[model samples]
Every structure is written in structure tokens, then in C-alpha cells.
Target chain A: MTSSNETVSREIQLAARPQGAPKDSDFTLVERQLGQPGEGEVLVRNLFLTVDPYMRGRMNDVKSYTPPFALNETMTGGAVGEVITSNADGLKAGDLVLHDAGWRTHALIPAKTARKVDLLPSISPSAYLGILGMPGLTAYAGLLEVAAFKEGDVVFVSGAAGAVGSVVGQIARLKGAGRVIGSAGSADKVAHLTEKLGFDTAFNYKDGPVSTLLKEAAPDGIDVYFDNVGGDHLEAALFAFNPFGRAALCGAISQYNATEPASAPRNLALAIGKQLTLKGFIVSSYSHLSAQFAKEVGGWIASGELHYDETVVEGIENMPGAFMGLLDGKNTGKMVVKL
Target chain B: MTSSNETVSREIQLAARPQGAPKDSDFTLVERQLGQPGEGEVLVRNLFLTVDPYMRGRMNDVKSYTPPFALNETMTGGAVGEVITSNADGLKAGDLVLHDAGWRTHALIPAKTARKVDLLPSISPSAYLGILGMPGLTAYAGLLEVAAFKEGDVVFVSGAAGAVGSVVGQIARLKGAGRVIGSAGSADKVAHLTEKLGFDTAFNYKDGPVSTLLKEAAPDGIDVYFDNVGGDHLEAALFAFNPFGRAALCGAISQYNATEPASAPRNLALAIGKQLTLKGFIVSSYSHLSAQFAKEVGGWIASGELHYDETVVEGIENMPGAFMGLLDGKNTGKMVVKL
Candidate 1:
């Protein structure tokens, strides 16, 4: 029998390389003993975990900006947890922290790897995984820096109901974009983007071809495109972009889980005539902007200038399901697994 | 009977729109009577006319940076002519002038529109069509200004034996590019690029695949790509670009005559990860740089540092064939019709 003071942690490991959309068999839930925090490590009891589109790229065994997840090892991502035991300086028990040890109930993380979070009653800890976290910074830097957003620009964003794109649309509006348009997979998500997120117009991509929908919604043509879902959305943006248009290619969620390589955008030749610019980026590449992003967006949240939504799962065992659901367009905004 | 003092002009008019490549029937050489020069106009006897790739875009009934060539009207392009009768104070007869009145043996042009060329004993007037004219400014602006070429950059130029690409390669080298690679259609053009143009390496694209050939030529990858031919060559540039690589998209000659819409570059997605920048430009957009370009490149020409080639097609009636030959890549550098 286990002693009352002896803690056992449950974790999920990558069981197999996913061929397409990840199935339940791709992840395995394993229970292990918390060996004890040593040296600069801390024993973290995870409170919340993040399930994101970018994680899909890590599942494939290919070299990219980041390395693929090692098969049969514990998968990693963004998470919020409490320190149960600390062997490192500047960290103590009962301290809430943000870390990158995902899909786990507890973690023994290096103190330097975990950042202390000052808990607030108004803001949820999981916000660090969504609007106030990596996703938020991605929206900020991608729109302003990568795409070179100008005031009064008509901006269009794909995956507008998701964590990053939702913030992208909102920030564009707040930053004085003349009009903001968005595309989502479902009608409810479309409604949320236009009604709640203040997008000038929103379309359910499943209703019709994106090229037709984009042309109808943004008749004057878009100046900036924040591309999250690639494939047809990218092609549509190419068709709808005006001269000197810019695209911040933050993600290609639509093609991430695809088994076969995606098709080329047939209309990209228009870019030559229009003088368009497209720049791709991962959020981690702009970590230095975190403090500035947090200060500005955090103010937006606190002042009711910005609103965000969350779909939370209750257990760590459901983490894989939440991730798969995100890829399937099941989440309206941020997807969080509350352990 | 016509008076011996009068000049009868032979002009090539766009008789019909071609379904694919322009045919002989698409052009009609008609004789026109000329009247005395008006208050601000000059009577010009055309000497040499330029046939270029961009003219193909103007042949179609589409709105672009420049106006389309009207059916049954005389075609317009770069030309060097003698001012036959000048009624304006600034100009005089016997002066060689440059104007946009191509495909004609003589022209009645506005005096303000015709820029008198200061005769240089060292440089041919046709050099204004190939190197000292719009094509020259296109290469300079596309390479240095548009692509933001930097010293030590490994540059790759497509259509390298052509007027624009040959100049692009030479300019990049003179600007201190680490390596200058070029691609052409024939082995003779390839040898011309490497041997005459001083390209670090040159390849005949017909030898094999552009992707394989480009990788073999620039194993270290390219920092700047001057895209004159867009197709497999553009796709190859995307594949061969290093991080932060820049491409000055000058023209898409390869896709200009395509019956159907051109297909997109398949690996354009790689741009996101590599942080590549591709910018398209038309020469007219940078017309302000002409005097500055002329001052610099004209010196290069006068000093014999810049060597240029021309395929001269004699007679105004052969203008159509010369343009067709340019589309066919029969010309090594600039294709000009001497009327």
C-alpha cells in the first residue's frame, strides 16, 4: 500500500506515429511514482494543460523548426501547475507556476524551466496557455511585426474562432483595422467571431468554397491575411489580396494532420502581379516580446476591451481527446484540460 | 502620287488577339500618312524598336500596371528614333530620342514624351533598349532595391542569358555577392552566362530538372533569387533559399503564354519556415530611379565593365516575328527590330 505522503503521478506518452488525424491509440496513459525533486528540480502537480494545433507537427517524425516528439516517450507542451516540492532556489511549495510539461498530472521540472505565476482570482491560470500566453504573443507579433499591419487595413484571418485567430481579429479591430473578416469551420464559431469577437464578417468555411466566401465577404480585397488554416484558405486569401498585401503564416492546421503532402495554391501566381508578401513564423521565435504582449493584452483583458472563451476538459486522461477535438474544430476559443 | 518631301510610315497594328502564342496574322503592317509637327509634338522617324516579354501581358484584354494594347491600334514599347521635325523649343531635328512608339517605322509623338538621347560614341543607341533603358533599370532596381541584396549573399538568377537576368547576375557580383549562379534555356546561353557574363556557375534548364540543377549549382543555398522565369525555376528557388532569402519577382516569362492559369509553387509553404520574402515589381513603378540608374550603369557601359548582347531583327514587318522569337527564347539578350 502507498503511504499518504508518497505521491504517484499519471502521464501520457506518445504510443505511435499518427498517420493522419490522431486516434486514441496514438497516446498511452501511464502511472509512475514521483521519484523526488533533485538539485534544481521541482515537483509540480499540474492544474491545467493545453491542447493546440502546433502539437500535431511534433507528432510527425520529420525535421522542422522544432524536433518531432520522440516515439514512446512522454509528450510535452504548455501547462500550468502548482509546486508540491521544490529543491531549487527561488521556488517553494504552494507556488503556482507555468511550465511546458504537458499531458501529465504531476511533473518534476527544473526550477529554471518553470516560471512562477502570481495567481489572480479574476484571471484563470489556464489563460497563460491561451490569450495571455503563447497564442496571444503569436497574434501580437504576427499581425504587427510579421505582416506589418497598418491602421485601417482590411484584415482577414482563418481559424478565427481558435485561440490565436480570435485574438488576431480582436487586436486588428482594436488597432484600427478598417474591417476585420474571419473564417471558421462551424456556424456557431462563425457567429461567435462576428457577434462576440467583433469581426466585421465571419463565414463557415464548410458552407461553400473559401474563395467564393472570401470574395463575397471582403469585396474590396484584404490588405493583411493571418493564415492559420492553409490549403483552400491560403488560396482564397491569395485571390482576395490587393496589391502590396501581406500574410502572416502562423500555422497550417488544415494540413498538419494530413497524411499526404498538401496541394499547391493554384492562384499564387496572382501574388506576382499584386506584389504580395507572406511570412511564416512559430511563436517561440519571438519570446522576447512576451513581456510587451502580456502587458498590452493583459490590460485588454482586465479592462473588458477583449473577451476570450475556453472549452475545458476535466481530466488528464482526456487530454488527447481535447487535442484531437481542437484539430477537428470542436473548440470555440482556447482548449484546456483541467487536471 | 505622294510628294517626295512627305514621309509615309509603316506601322504594325494589333489586328487580332491570339489564342496562344501570337501568330503572323495577329499583326498587320499598314502605311500611314504623317502631317506637320504640332505645337508640342515632334515628327519622329523610328530607327530601332524593342520587343520584350512584358508586351505579352499587354496583348491581352486585362487591366494591369500598364494599359492593354488595343486591337487595331499600333503597339507601343521602347524605341530609339530620330526627331524628323521638332516644333518644340527643347528639341531639334537630327537628335536621337527614346520613346514608347515601337513597332513602327515613324511616329508623331509629343515632344515632352520623347527624351532626347545624348549621343555617346562608346554605346549603341540600341543599348538604351537592352541595358540603358527600362530593362537595365529593372535589373538594378529588382536586385538592389527590391530584393535588398546584401554583400556576401549567394545570388541565383533565372533567364540568366536574357537582358534582365544577365544584368541582375552581373550587378549582384559587382555588389559583392558571394556567388552568382544563373539558369538559361540552351547550352550556348549557359556558356555565354558563365564565360561572358562572369557568372560563378550556369546551367541550361533543359538539361534536366531545375530543382536538381539548382541544388547542384548552389549546394550552400541561395540568399537572393532574381526570378525572371517563373515555373519550375521559382519552385527551385523556394527549395534552394536559405533563411531570410529574398526573391525579386521581375517576370514570369515561362507562364506568360500559358493557355490556362499557372500552377502555384508547391514548396511555397517552405517560405514560412525559412522566412523568405518574394516581392513582385514592374519597371514603370520605379521610373524615378532612371536618371540615377543611367548615371551608374551608363558609366559601367562606357567603361566597358558592362557587356551586353542583342539579336537584331531587320525591318518593321518582322517586329511580330521578333516578339514571337523572344517568347520562344531565340534571342540571347534583348530582341530588337531595326526599322
Candidate 2:
């Protein structure tokens, strides 16, 4: 018989590496007793959790920039939290912070892993995990540096209503790009991209062939392509790229959950002919650009030049559902969970 | 039958668009009378010609950095020649110069395309067509700027005995790179890369799988990958890349002649995991860096810090065979033809 004080932690862990598309069975939620924080560590009451596409890659045991999560450990993710009790300096009762504290109710993290939030200026704490954080920096650095955006350059963005993609389209326009076009999975998302985010043109990728839609939207050809969805989206971008065009490959959300390997690009030969520059990048590679990113994106947000939306789930237990919904293109913008 | 004078003026024209790999049947050599030089023009007696991998991309009727080769017109290429007649003010007869004069014995070209060469002072005239020309600038700019080499960084070169790859490996060493590893098709080519070209380690790609060879050569991990052969070589580099590794993709000889579509890389997911920066480039994209290239590389050759080789065929009539050999990886270095 279990005692009343012996509480269950109720955390999810990687059960097995998926061969292709991940299923619910790949995860196992376990209940265990919580451990107390040791020296120089703080116990965080995780308030808001983040479910991102990058986590899907971490589930695989392949070698990458960051190490994969081992089986039976709590699944890793970004989270915003309140420090309940602390042994670390400068952190006190009821102070909010951002950290890579996994999917759980509470965590005991080293002082260094948790960054104290200065919510003194009245910035929303949830925004620290979304628009003002990694996703915003990703859009800024990938578009400006990797894509080499110049004044009057026509830009095209794929998966344009998602977390990073929405910010990418708006940032390109703010940097003086001439015409910005976007692609989304649903009519509502497409409408949001154009009506809410100021995208010049937007298309529902599922409505028709992307090549036909892209040609009609970008008759002059695209100077820069910020790719989030790979597969047919990349092929269409190839056909639509102008001479000396640049492509910033940020993600391939379309192929992340594929049961079989993705198809080879039909227009692979065009890369050489057009003298195109295609760069694959991770946000962490340009971490030095963070201060510059904060200043520019923060100013843009303050001046109403950039806008963002978030889909929030209220409980930590719903993170798996949120992640699955992200893969299915269900969320309109950045997806976060309120703990 | 054609007269010798008519043959001298004639040129091979694009007769049919190639569906996959180009064949000799796609060209038609015809005879015509040479035209006189107009104002600001010089008539060149073409002495040498360059055939490159990028030319293969231009044979198809597609949009590119430069316009596609027109049907029933001379195929465009860079050439070195003697000025037979000059109506341009700054040029005179008997001066050696270089220009984009196409595949022909003689051409009337604008003075702007013709840059005067002082072959009498230092380097051989053929050096202008090989080491001191476009291929040289390509190696210099792409390696130094795009790869971002630092002293002690380990470098790997694919197609290491080829024109650009040979220069890239040598320059990396000259710039204080710790170790230079290279891969070529044959044992003789491998020996040349190590002994003559000064690569620290050289491997015959045909000896075994590239992944195994790469692991043995770069046990510590590759800091930079200069990719000239794309398919398996790119995959191998991805496997061996260290964190923050940079890949400057200059060419993809393995995929150029592929009749069917190549496979999608199974290891592409590594780009995000390792934070690897893989950038595709055409040399001309960095034209602003040309003056700096001329100063540095020009000095390197003058001081014997860099060495280059050319595989030259005796006559322009053998151009097709030479090009075929290039596609088959027969040349040891830069492939050129003497007219």
C-alpha cells in the first residue's frame, strides 16, 4: 500500500528510439519521488513548458551538435519557471527564470543552467521562451546573415505561420525586403500570415501544387528562401529561385516524422546553374549574434514592426499532445504550455 | 570539305539541348568568315581554352547566373589569346590577353573583357589560363572567406588532385591549418596530392568506403570540409565533422553526370545536431574579394608557397575527349586545351 506523502513525480521518458514516425508508445510516463536540491542549486516550480520540433531529433541516438536524451531520463525541453527555494546567489523566492528544465512539475537545476529573468521592465515571462528568445534569434540570424538579405530583395518563407516561420517573414520585411510571400498548411493560417502578419502574399500548401502557387505569387522570382518545410517545398523554391539566389535552411519539419526517407529533389541540378547559395544553420551556431538580435527584435516589437502569437496548453501533462500537434501543423504560431 | 581559313573562323554551336549528360552529338561545328574588329574591340587569335564543370550546367535550357547557351550559337568559355588586330585605344597587336571568347579559333571581343597580361616578366602564359585565372581566384576566395579557416584547424579536401581542390588543400596548410587530408580516385593521384601538393594525408577513394577512410585520416574530427565530390563524400564529411564545422561546397562532380536522381542524404539531419554550417557557393558570388585574391595568391605563387599543375590536350579538336576525361576524373589537375 502507498503512503499519502510518497507522491508521484509523473514524468515522461524516452521508451525506445523510433525507426521512422514516432508513436505514443515511444514515450513512457513514470511516477517517482522527487529529490531535494543539493548545494548551489535551486528547486524550480516550472510554470510554462515549451514543446519544439528540435526535441524530436534529440530522441534519436544519432550523433549531432547536442547529445541525445538517454532512455528512461526525463524528456528534455525549454521551460520558464519560478524559484520556490534557493541555495544559489541572486535567486530568491518567487523569481521567474528560463531554463532547459525537462518535462516535470519541479526541477533541481545547477545555478548556471537557469538564467534569472529581469521581468522588471514588464515583459511577459512566457515571451522569454518564445518571440524574445531562441525562435526570434533563429529568424533574425538565419534571415539576415545566412540569407544575406539586401534592400528590395524578394523573399519567400515556408511553414510561414509557425513559431519561427512567422517571425522570419516579418523580420525580412522589417529589413527592407521588397515582397514577402509565405506558405502554410491551412486556410486560416494563410489568412493569418497575410492579414495579421503583413505578408504580401500567402498560400495554402495543401490547396494545390506548390510549384504552380509559387510561380503565380512570385512572378519575378525569389531572391531569398527561408525554408522550414522541406520535400516539395524545397523543390518549388528551386524552381522559383532567381539568379544568385540564397536559401537559408532552418528546418525540415515536413520530413521529421516521415516513416520512409524523403524524396530526392528533382531540381538539384539547378543549384549549380543558378550559382545559388544554400546554407543549413542552427541558431546556436550564431549565439554571438544574440545581443544584436535582442536589440533589433526588441526594438521592432516595441515599435509594432513585429507581431507574434502563441498556442498555449495549460498543463505539463499535455506536452506530448502539443508536440504531436506541432508535427501535424496544428499550431498557428509558437506553441507553449502553461504549467 | 572546308577551306583551312574557313575552318579557323568556324566554331562549334549548341545543336540540341542535353536531356541528362551532354554528348558530342549535341554540338555542330560550322565554318564562316571572321569579322573585323569594331571600335573598342580587339580580334583575338585564340591560343588556349578552359572547359569546366560549371559549363555542363549551362548546356541545358534553364535559368542560371548567366544566360543559358542559345541554340545554334557558339558555346561560351574563357580563353587566352594574342591580339591579332585592335581598334581599342589601350590594346595593340601581339599583346597576350584573356577574355570570354567562347570555343573558337578567333573572336572579336570588347576591350573590357580582354585584360592585358605581362607574360614576358614572370609566370608562363598558360599559367594565366590555369593558376592565375578564374580557378585560382575561386580556390582563394572560397577557402579563406567561406570556410573561415583558423590556425590549427584540421581540413579535408574532396577531389583533392583536381584544379580547385589541389589549391584549397595547399592554401589551408599555408594559412597554418594543423593537418590536411585529401581524397582522390587513383593511387597515382593520391601520391601526387601528398608528395607534390603537400597534403598531410591522402587517400584513394576507390580503396574503401569514404567514411572508414575519413575516420582513419581525421581521428580528431574535421574542422573544415572543402567538398568537390558531393554524394558519398559529403555524407562522410558530415559523419566526421566536429562541432561548428564549416563545409564550403565548390562542386558536386559525383552528381553532375548522374542520369537518374541521386538519393536523399540519410545523414542530413546531422546539420542541425552538430550545428554544422554547409554552404554551397559559385566563385563569382565573391567578386568583391577579387583584388585581395590577386594580391595574396599572386604573391603566394611568386614566392613558391603555392604550386599548381595543368593537364593540357594538344588541340581544340580534342576538346570533347578532354571534357569527357574530366567528367571521368581522368585529369590530375586543371584540364585545359591548346588551340
Candidate 3:
């Protein structure tokens, strides 16, 4: 969908709070008249948007790292856009930018808030929303830094076909992990991990219990586990952890939408005997590492040492459905909505 | 209970493995002929024997930090004794010593495994089995090193009336912790914690729910948690943990005798958002710090800053009952049997 030429901006607003799994009706399409940018402000036409699992946390009225999304207001998230007009000295019209003005086709943003981006010959602007953006930084810092990855350590990753998990497995291998294993929801994604992403081995968690599959994949046990899907995945990872093992707890997509609390790991006692360390974190916690992250991971992508995939949904109207679908595992890799 | 000139040594042996809570039938009273000390060995007439919760873990025929106790065997643990006979260099008859010769009135032990005690008249020989022995070392290393205690950090301890937990709270306070709170199983134990052990506040976990009690105890949040009791206590600590909080997971006494595996903290997700670190450790992991630990904690005791208690049971025949009582929370601090 193109930005309205009639001076009105189309945006997605939270019509109601979700009870469990979010439905399309929970969001509504609305329009607002575009106003001229004031000093240090710019008007942007949003092009590519990110719909991530963490957005689910922001939907709740509970205390968290970020504030909750207020009902009847335009939902905001990460987006890449073109500056239609600028009142700030550093930026101008036609400049491509990245900003937290998602769920809308056009946004009146402070020019200081929108970061100017250079269109690389080899990299797409939308790639900044996935591989070169928050997701990539999360995978990078959560593994090498937060989990304190050691060279030649065996690594296990859950939700391994998705944006962060896929990058974590590849990064582990590239950084000298002895063996890298990934668990995905389907045989195709599992095949893609090993065959396409260069993971050492991959398995479909749907085939059997995660514990049995993990035991078979890494019979000797894993030194590090990057957890994206919590619940049984976290429990199974605890079972397969070696002595002095570390687990980087990044997300719990499995229990994110649950109306009731999820069941906890029954064998957590194993952690005590194993001298295990489990650390939970958000990527934003290590935002200072982004400069180095972009430099390192950017080189990998440029030299084709890393490969990435994107699942695209069309139009701002499709954002809510894509996000819900992402939660349901209907999409692979980074699920993005292109307007 | 006197050393029988009759040449027979009274002992408590594992009669069978326990199923749930250890039963009386699981243990048996036995007798052995007292043998003369061989070369490189010493004959120890046991004075004080320690019965710890960890012994319950040894009863199960599963791999753990230490080997499982074989059926009908005299269980080995920390004890203080008098050297009745010595056939090794540097050790003499009638010398006081400490050795892992618990559950028996007389023990034939390798001299290399027995360390001679200076017999500090200021401190009882039994105090070595509690305050200056394995339990004390466990609390020292677990709190200061493993938990990475920083001055002014708010500290919370679970199983706060037991041998290890009691020392942990005192150490946190003596080291300049901002506030110290403890959770125990009974009103008497809670009273003893706040009234005698110098804890800032103490609560009976049996009096109310742990989460509610914890929220009331530390309204702001806790910076460090020394976990001796696991299960719900761990879950509650996770809830009350501040950003970058650390937990030294010392023991899961609450789950040691559990027939079924215990549920882990369902809200373990809080660890992710708060950048929490949970590290499980056995004291032996830090045994290298024992010399330093003894010097420091011993100094605390010398200054009267450290106080210790032992609930003594007389005779080797009562060893099994004292051990079961330790697990049942019948004792206030260290539970030891005197021969």
C-alpha cells in the first residue's frame, strides 16, 4: 500500500488488548492528517517494518523493560522508511532512514530520532530490519558475550530456524564451536539449518520429545545453550547441559501467549550438580556492543560467510496477522511486513 | 557410649535405599571388630559426627558430586575424633583430629586423610564439625565468591536457620550488605534468625506464601540471593530479584527427598528481563578457598561477630534419627551426634 497522497497517514492502532493469542480484530486501521515537521523533526514514509516476539510483552499492562502499548493509539515498533521532509540539519528529503515508527505508513518523527542509512549495493535496506538490526545484535551479544561463548564448545540452539536462533548457530560455528546443533519445528527448516545455514546438525522438535532428540544429536552433552523457546525446550536444554555449562536465556516464545503460567522444568536440580549458569537478557541490555556487532556480522554477510532468510507479508494491514502467524511458527526466519 | 574396651565398634549402616522420605528400615545398627591402626593409618575414637542434608543425596544410587552410599556401608562424612592409635609419621596417639568418619563410634582411617586439630580450647571440637568445617566453608565460598557479593547489595537467604544458610546471612551482613533477610520453616527458627543471628529481618515461610513474604521483606528488590532451599523459594527470589541480580544456588534441601521431581521457577523468564544470573555450585568446587575461608570466618568467630549452634544427639545409635531430624527441620543449626 502506498502512502496516501491526500495528506492523511494510514496507521494500525490497538483496538483492544488480546486475551491470549492475538486476533486480527484486536487491531484496527485508522487515518490521521499529516502535519508539517517542526524544528528538529521529519516526516517519513515507512517502507519496511519488523514484527517481533518481544512485541507480545509490550502488549501486556505488566511492568517490563518497555512501556505497554496504549489502546486506541498507533502501535509503534522498528521500521525502515524514507524521509519525505526534514527540518533537522543532518537529514533531508529522500534520505533513507530507520526509526521506531512502525504500524504506520507515515510518521512525523524528530529528525534526531531517525537514523540515516546508506543503501549498500549488496545489502537491502530491509536487511537492516533483520540480519543487521536488533535481531542480529541479540544473537551476537546473547551468544558470544552474554553466554560467554568459549571456542570449541558444543552449542545447542532452540528455535534455530528463526532470525536470532539461526544467527546464533551460524555464529557459534564461525567462532569455533566444536559442534553446533539446532532444533526447529519442521523438517524443512531443520534441513535448511544444516544444509543452508551450515549448522553442524539439525533436528525437527516435532519428531519427538526434545530431550530424546537433543540426546541423540549431542550424546556427549552441550557446553552452551541459546534458548529462544522456553518451557520444555528450556527443560530439555537443562537435561543436556554439561558440567560448567551456560545457557543464554533470550526469549520464551512458547509461553509468551499462554493465558496461564507455563509448567517449569522438573529436573532443574541438574543445574546444581552440573555447575550451570543461566543468564537472561534483552538485546537492548548490550546496545553498546552494536557498533562492533555491525562491523563483525556485516563482514560475514558481505563475504557470504553468513546466510539469512526473510518471510514477508504485504501491507501495514497485514502486520497483526503476520505477528500472530510468527508466534504460531507459520513463517521462517525474520518475519517482516513490506508496505 | 564410652569407647568399649570390649573391642567392638558401634556403627550406623545403610540398610536399604530410601524411596521417598528416608525410613527407619532404610538404616540399621551394626557392630564391627575394632582393628588396630595399620601403617599409614590412624584409629579414631569418634567424638562428634556430622549428619548433613547432603547425606540424603548420597543415599540414592545415582551419580552426584560424591559417590552414592553402598547398602550396609558405614556412611562417610565430616567428623571430629580422638586418635586412639597412630601408625603414621607426624600423628600421635590421643591427638584430636578431624576426618570423614561419620556414623560410627570408631574408625580406621588413612592418616593422610585425617588432619590434626590444634584443639582451640576457646572453641569446642564439635564446632569444627559445624562452624569451621565443610558447612562453614560452603557458606563462605558460596556467598562471597560464587554469589559475587558486593558491599551494599541487598541479600536474601533461604533455609536461613540451617548450617549453611545461617552462616551465609551473617557473612553477608559482616561484609557490609545493605540489608539481609532470611526465610525459615518455623516461627522459632525465624525468631532465632532475627533475634540471634543478626539478620535484618526473618520470616517463617510456613506463616505465609514466600512471594508475598519476600515482597514485604524487600520492597525494593534483592541484589543477591543465597539459595539453600529450592522450589518455591527459588521462584520467589526470582520474582524479587533486581536487574543484574546474582543467585548462588547452594542446595535444594527441600527437593532432596522429593519422591517426584520438583517444579522449577515458572517465572524464570524474569531472569531474562532483569539480567539475572543463577549459578549452582557444590562447596567442593571452591575447596581451594578453604584456607582463606577458615582464616576469615575464624577471625569473625574470634571477634564474637560469628556465633554458631549445634543440636547434639548422644550416641551412634541416634545418628539415623538425628539425620532424619535434620531433613525434617527439627534442629536449629548444625545437627550432630556425639559418641
iRMSD, all candidates: 2.0, 2.8, 1.2
> What ordering of candidates by DockQ runs from best to worst?
3, 1, 2
- Over B1-339, each residue of candidate 3 has an lDDT whose tens digit, in order, gives 435443577888899999989989999999888767778989989999999998999999998778999998888898899988889998999999999878888888899999999965588899888889889998999899888999999999998999999999999999999999999999999999999999999899987779999999999999999998888899999999999999998888889989987876778888888889999988788989989988999899999998888799998888889999899999888999988
**Candidate 2 wrongly placed segments (more than 4 Å):** A1-8, A35-39, A87-89, A118-125, A145-151, A259-261, A265-269, A272-275, A285-306, B1-10, B35-41, B86-88, B110-112, B120-123, B264-266, B285-305
TM-score of each: 0.96, 0.89, 0.97
- Candidate 2's residue-wise lDDT over A272-332, tens digit each? 5466777778888789999999888888888878899999877766777877888888897
Give model 2's TM-score for chain A to 2 decimal places: 0.95
| Model 1: per-residue Cα lDDT at residue B74 | 90
- Cα distance off (Å), candidate 1, residue B280: 1.8
- Candidate 3: RMSD to truth: 2.3
For model 2, residues B166-214, the per-residue Cα lDDT tens digits are 9999999999999999999999999999899899999999989898999
lDDT of 1 by residue, A130-207 (tens): 998888899999999899999999999999999999999999999999999999998889988988889999999999
TM-score of the A chain in candidate 1: the value is: 0.98
Q: What docking tier does model 3 reach?
A: medium
lDDT of 1: 0.89
Using DockQ as the yardstick, the better of models 1 and 3 is 3
Kindly list the per-residue Cα lDDT of model 1 for residues B1-339, writing each as its tens digit.
577656799999999987789999999999988777889989998889999998998898986667899999998988999998999989999999999988899899899998988877866789889898888999999998989999999999999989899899998888899999999999999999989989999999999989999999999999999998887898899989998899888888888888876664767767776777878777877888888898888888778788788999999988899999999899988888887
lDDT of 3 by residue, A122-172 (tens): 777888889899999999999999899999999999999999999999999
